[model samples]
Target: MDVVKPKNQRSKRALEKRAPKLIENPKTAMFVRGGHISQIVTDVMTDLCKLKRPNAVLYRKKNATRPFEDPTTIEFFSQKSDASLFMYGSHNKKRPHNIVFGRMFDHHLLDMIELGVEQYKPMSSFTSIKSSVGIKPCLIFSGDSFETEPNYAKLKNLLIDFFHGSDVERVDLSSLETVITFTVSDGKIFMRVYHIALKKSGTRTPRVELEEMGPSLDLVLRRTHIASSELFKLATRRPKALKPKKEKNISKDPFGSKLARIHMTRQDMKQLKTRRVKGLKRKRDTAQEEGEGTESSPKRQN
Candidate 1:
C-alpha cells in the first residue's frame, strides 16, 4: 500500500506557484545639429509625451568653453525631463554650434510591466513629434547685402512639405522689419525659433539664436495637414490624356501597297477593254472578207 502525501506539503506546493515575470526597460539617445536643434526638440516632445502643450527650461551658459570665454556666453540648454531637450554651443569669439538633442525614458517602470518605452510614453513628450498647428510655420532670413528670398522660399517649402500631414490647413509667409513670425492657430505649444547672424561677409547663412513660441499641439497639427480635396482637384485639373495609337495593318505593306494595287487595277481594266475592242474589230473584218470572197466566186462561175 502507498503512503498518502501530507496536507502541509500540498499547501506548500500550491503557495510556490511561479511569480509573475518582469521586463527590463530600454535606453536610447539622439544628437541633433545646432541648426536643427529647435526643430528636433519640438518633434521629440510632441512625439513622446502626447501632451497638448509642453514646456522646457532654457539656460544660457557662461565660461563653459575654453580660454578667452565671455561671461554668460558659451552655450544654452532647453531641458524637460518628460520631454527631450536641445543643447546649442554659443560663443562670442567662435562659431556657435548645435551640440545634441535627446530623450531619456523611464525604463525601469516600463520594463517591470514588460512594455516598450513607446507603449508607456505619450507622443507629446517628444519635441519634434508634437501635433502641428493648423497653420504651417514659415522660415525667413533678413539681409540687405544678399537676396536670399528665393533660397529661403525653397527651404521653407521643403521644410513645410517634410513636416506637413494630412490634417494641415494652410501655410502663410510674411516678413516685417528684423523679426519673422510663423503665426499658428491655437498657439500654446513650445516652439523655439533660432536666429544666427554670420560673421563672414557675403555669406547667406546667419549666426544662431533660439526662442520658444506657438499655439497648442492640436492646432499645430491641423495647420500641417494638406487637404485631400485640394490635392484631388489639382490632380484632376491637368490630366495628361494619352493619344490613341493607330493599329497598323501589318497584313499589308507599311509603305502603302494600296496605292500600287489601285494602279494595277486601272491597268487591268484598260487591258480588258482593249482586248474586247480588238476582238470585235477582228470579227467584223473576217465577216467582210468572207462576203467579198463569196460574191467574187459566184461572179466567176456565171
Candidate 2:
C-alpha cells in the first residue's frame, strides 16, 4: 500500500531534517587579554577583524594574569559584554608564543584550544597587496576523507564556525576561484590563501588561475571538543557512592599502630596514688626539719 503525506507535514519534516545555521546578525563581540601580542597572533587578529565587519566587531583589551586558568570569570565578563567569542595570547618560558581561541556556550566560556605557532609571516610583509577591503574572500575546506575521518569532520566544523559564513564550500576539481583553501593530507592541515583570476576560453567560460597571497601559517589542532549532550549529562550526574568507613575500637590506643591493650587492676591504681602522695609528704617533712635546725642555731649565735 502507498500513502501520500500532507504538504504541511512534508514541509515540517524537511525543516526538521535541515541543520540549524547560526547567523551573525549581531556582530560577534570578542575580548582580548592585555599582554604582548606576538606577530602571528596580531596577523590572526587582523584576519578576524577583516572577516568580521569593522562596525560590527567590538573588542577590548583586559589586563589578565593567566586568564585561561579561571574560565568562570572570563564567562562573567563575556556575558557582561554580550560577547560570544574571545581570544588571548601569552608567551613564557614554559609555554612560549601561543594563542588561545575560545567560544562561549550559553554565556559561559566553553571549549578553548591553545595553538603554538612555529613561524609566522605578516600581511604587511608582502609588497603587492591586491586583496582589497570589503571583498568577502571565499573560504574552502578540502579533504578527500573528511566524510569518513572524525578529526577531519570536527576540524571542518570548527573552521566553519570560526569563519562564520554560510557561503563557505568544500573544494573540488570544479572549485576554481576559491580564495583560501585548507587541505588536509598525511595528518597535516595546509592553509593556502590566493588571488584567483578567470581567463576566457575560445567558446567557454574563463578558466580559473590562482596567485599566492601573503601571511600564511600552519595550524595543529588538538582533539578536545566535548559533546554538548555529554557535558549536560556530566553536569546532572549523581554523586558517587561513599565507601563504608572502618570503626575505631576503644580498647586499642588510637595513637599506636597494632599495639596491644594493657589492662590495669584497682590495686595497681591505688599503689600509684599512694606512691605519689608519699613522695610529696617526704619532700615537705625534709624541708620543715631543716628550717627547725636553722632556727635553733641562730638563737645560740645571738
Candidate 3:
C-alpha cells in the first residue's frame, strides 16, 4: 500500500477524512466497468448506484483493468476517490456478466469477490413503489449457508459493508422502509430488494409487509479473497472510546434498562430492639403494671 503525502490544504483535508475516528464517515464506493460490458452489466451497475446514491462514483468511460492481475489501478482509484469500497463489472467471453465486489483497507485490497450474475432484473423492470434516495436500508442475510459456510460468511460481510449506508445511533421502524435480503442456497446467492409496507395494525405498531421493488439477482459465487484471521481482526479493530465499557455488577435488560447489583450486610433480627406491646409482654412485668394501675384508680375513686 502506497501512502500519499498531502501537499495542499485540500489534500490534507482528504487525508483527514480517511483517518480513523470514533464515528467514522460513511464509506464511498467507486463503480467501474471494463471496456467490454454487456447490457445486463450496465443495468446492474446503474441500479446499484441508484441504491447507493450520492456516496457512489460512476465512471462514464470504460477502463481496461483486471483486478486479479493488477490491482494497482483500483488501489490508486480507491485512494484518489477516498472510497473504501468498490464494484467492478466486466462481461467477457470466458466469464459473461461478471461483477467483482471488493473492500479496501488502508487504500489496499482487503477482499475481492467475483460473482457471476446469472439472472438479473433491474429496478426499472419493476414498476412498483421505490424507496427514496439516500434512505438507509435494512440488510438481512438469511439461509444456513451464510452462517455455516466460511465463503458465504465472508460474502455476507462484504455485502453488509457495501450497503450498510450511513452509521446511525438509533433505528426506528419508520426509517426501515427499504430492506435488502440476501439468501444463500445451493452455492448461489439470491439478492432481493423490497420496500416495506406498514399497514394498519389497529395499534401503534403497524403491520409490516415486504414488496419486492427490483434489482433482483441470482449470483453464483466465483473466486474470492477472504482476509486471514489476523488481518481481518486488525481491520475490524475499533477505537476504545466507541467500544462499550464493561461495568462490573451491572447489566442491561431487553428494554435497555440499567440493572445493578446492590450488596448489603446481613441484618440481625434480635438486635432491632423494637418496643413490645403490653399484651405480649412477660407475665411478671405485666402483673406489676396492672397492680400499679389498680392502686392509682382506687385512690382516685375514694
Clash count of each predicted structure: 56, 0, 0
| Candidate 3 wrong stretches, greater than 4 Å | 1-11, 199-207, 252-259, 262-302
Candidate-wise lDDT, in order: 0.29, 0.58, 0.90
Best by lDDT: 3
Ranked by TM-score, the better of candidates 2 and 3 is: 3
- Which has the better TM-score: candidate 1, or candidate 3? 3
In model 2, which regions exceed 4 Å deviation? Answer: 1-31, 34-36, 55-62, 65-67, 127-136, 143-152, 166-178, 185-188, 200-204, 222-227, 230-302
Tens digit of per-residue lDDT, candidate 3, span 53-161: 8899998789999998899989999988889999999998899999999999989989889999999988988877999988899888889988888888888889988
Could you tell me the lDDT of residue 197 within candidate 1?
Answer: 25
lDDT of 2 at 261: 47
Q: Which run of 10 residues does model 2 get worst, by summed lDDT? A: 18-27
For model 2, residues 24-136, the per-residue Cα lDDT tens digits are: 23325464644665555666666555545432243446355455567776677676655666666666556666666666666675566665655566655655445654445
CA shift of 88, model 1, Å: 16
Of the two candidates 1 and 3, the one with more favorable lDDT, higher being better, is 3
What is candidate 1's lDDT per residue for 1-302, written digit by digit as tens?
99555479765664343221132111112122222223333343333222111232333222243211211221221121222222222212232212222222221110000000111222333243222332223344333211343323333343333222223334332211112233322322122332222244456654333323222222121111122455435522532344345545433577656422222333554346444454567777889988998988844453
Candidate 3 lDDT trough over 10 residues, lowest sum: 293-302
- The candidate with the higher lDDT, 2 or 3, is 3
